[model samples]
Target: MTKEIAVLGAGSWGSVLASVLDENGSHVRLWSYNEKQVAQFNETHTNPKYIKNYTFSESITAYHDLAAAIDGVDYILFVVPTQVTRSVARQVAAILKDRNHSVNIIHASKGIEEKTYLRLSQVLSEEIDPENRQSISVLSGPSQAEDVVTHDITLVTVASDNQRAASEIQDLFMNNYFRVYTSDDVIGVEFGAALKNIIALGAGALYGLGYKDNAKAALMTRGLAEISRLGTSFGANPLTFIGLSGVGDIIVTATSTNSRNWRAGNELGRGESLEAVIKNMGMVIEGVATTRAAYELSKKRGVEMPITSAIYHVLYDGADIKETINQLMTREGRSEIG
Candidate 1:
């Protein structure tokens, strides 16, 4: 019942997932490009830089060598940030290219790449070998690394067109504290995962502006509306937006202190400049990139997404956050149905 899982990337999410898999009685090869972090994990059993205070399972083998980390692995779980997905995938492909390994890949990160505007799954398809792409699956939901590392009850959806692939991933990830559900709608699940980060930024801005609960509530509701509109426009099931990856993801990202996107928005709302906020966060706020991608997606698909447009302007054009808010609020009133 044991499997080898190569976890590429050593960020908070990667460390947390490695801990989860190790606890679930799997051999986890926790690969980090940073040798120092790998040494830290091996010595202390804790990813001191990311998920602090919790010790990882001893079953985790931290490795600095990419090929060694992936060797003999049956499954690859990518926990790298969205921006780095391609680079990591390419490195992994080069290592696994020659071998006719029947490995399944699961991607946990969410975000569309800005310049190419390609989804994470798309990036994987392009970077990984064609044989491996058929076995690719995406795991996404309202889950956070901080909560998962502490063994908080978290539910996530593992989606792939291949039912067997989903079932395999669900078995690998399911445990007492973590529940995995399977869905066939990969596009829907992925879109929900990527787009919710944008709404979270909006919610964080409201919180930072001292807005009351009513304002926050309204923002979240409308945020979902815009996100679903965009998702459905692109052949994603509208119902998926109501599930874990959509509404569930939106609530967690918008409200949780662990959300990097929300933190960035809060800083912006508190009158800090976008550059200053990003510099302080020291991490990729996926929503920032998603905003630009979503804006482009909306224009290309003829779907209206005012919220994403506002965020994009504030982030890219040096527009004042307050001015962006006023622009949104002052838009010509129309029927909610329209």
Candidate 2:
């Protein structure tokens, strides 16, 4: 039996998911904020804006109408960039409330809101009604849309407080090219998803400074340690940091050219100012905002995340890259294994 799934945003990640869901035999209604993307997808069955050169599956319907997209939807996938999640969620909630129907929401965006510092799941919970909150979940990992859309083998995790809902989502998205794992520790999943991007920026900065693999590996490993420590302080399972959403994600994002954050950091390392790098990317490099949020989160939680702090300083406080690297390297040495 096929399910009706509505995917918000028609960017690379959103389009990739629409293809994956349709390939799994679900009827997908993909909404695009860009009228051009919608027109292209509707007319040519191909999204030229993000995932070009690949046709949207015949089972996937592209839409520009919010209400029409949510009509009789079983599961709603919010794939919009992290910055716009709250706005999109508010719109969806209004539609759901007007229709007096609840839909299971799975957000694939990865970031902490800049001003509120709220995780994507928390943003949804606060914006959506209590009834809708019960069905919210998050899917995140090292999976990139460019790779996933090409049918590369990818592994990701789905997290929700409701185990049954997580399992249902797992069944809905898992395919030959993709594998989904389930977790009930929503905090660990969400924190790992957001914080890894900040660490990725730091790693990219290190690479931009002409650091070797050993230095990169050290930064990534220590970054994961601090992330786990901070997550554990927030009542999350520490072990999840060692899983796909944590260390696995950090490795991929920090090292891959496909990572916008990494690419942005590389430009910064090459002596470009933050403004120039962002203007060149032409999309929200989530880590820039996430670094600020994580810095605040660590201070609030009383957890020490040196790498996050360093990255935040470099990006926002005008800290020199060389000085930041020296500060990280000169920190009091600790035992290798935790």
Candidate 3:
């Protein structure tokens, strides 16, 4: 049977995922808040604004109307920026209140909320009525839209507390070029996904500063430790950190030039202002916001994330990159295990 799925957020990842679903024989409605972008997608079947060198699947319809896009769909996949998730959820909740059949909820957006500190799923659970939803899950890994759109082999994990929900999602996305794995560790997956971007920023800074492989290697190892430390503190399984959502994601995100967070950090390391980097990039750099959120999260939870702290200061406090690096190296020696 052909399934109908609503993919919210017409950005790079949304378009790519819609194409993936379409290729898997699902009818996909790609929704965007931008009317112009919707018209462009429906008319020209191209999206050069968010991602270049790719064409949208014409079989997938584009929608500016959220209710119309989602009506009667079996799934709603959110690829929106984390900051706007709450508002979008409220709208979805309103529409779903009158619906009889339940739709599964999933998000690929990675971030702990800035002020409230809620996960995107938590926000969805809070705003969306439970009776109207079947299960909430997250899809995350080291996927960059640029590579995935080109049909490079990609592996990602979709996690839900409900095993059935995870498997169902896996079936929808799995293909020759894209493989899906299922996990029950939503906390570890989400945290790992969100925290890695912060480390990737640090990694980008290292590369931009002309640091070589040694520095990159040290940063990645310690960054994983920091990620595990904070992740386990919240009752997330330690083993989850070594899985696709953890070390696997860290490897690609920290090393890939295709990462927006990496590119943003490279510009910052070259002494460009955050404003200029963001403006020139013309997209949301999730790490910039995640840095602030994680900085505060670590302090609130009493987790020692030195790399996150350093990047936080550099990003939010206007600290110099080299000086911060010096401070990090000069900190009193501690056990390697610590």
lDDT on C-alpha atoms for all candidate structures? 0.87, 0.88, 0.92
RMSD of each: 1.3, 1.5, 0.9
lDDT, residue 139, model 1: 93
Candidate 3 versus truth, CA RMSD in Å, comes to: 0.9
User: Candidate 3 lDDT (Cα, whole model)?
Assistant: 0.92
Model 1: weakest 10-residue lDDT segment is: 94-103
The true-versus-predicted C-alpha distance at residue 260 of model 1, in Å, is 1.1
lDDT of 2 at 56: 73
At residue 14, give the lDDT of candidate 2. 86
Candidate 2 lDDT over residue span 192-256, tens digit each:
99888887887777788898799888888889998898888878898899999998899899899
Best by TM-score: 3
User: Considering only N, C-alpha and C atoms within 3 Å, which residue pairs clash in candidate 3?
Assistant: none
Model 2 weakest lDDT span, ten residues long: 47-56
Q: What would the TM-scores of all predictions be?
A: 0.97, 0.96, 0.98
Question: In model 1, which runs have C-alpha deviations exceeding 4 angstroms?
Answer: none
* TM-score result, candidate 2: 0.96
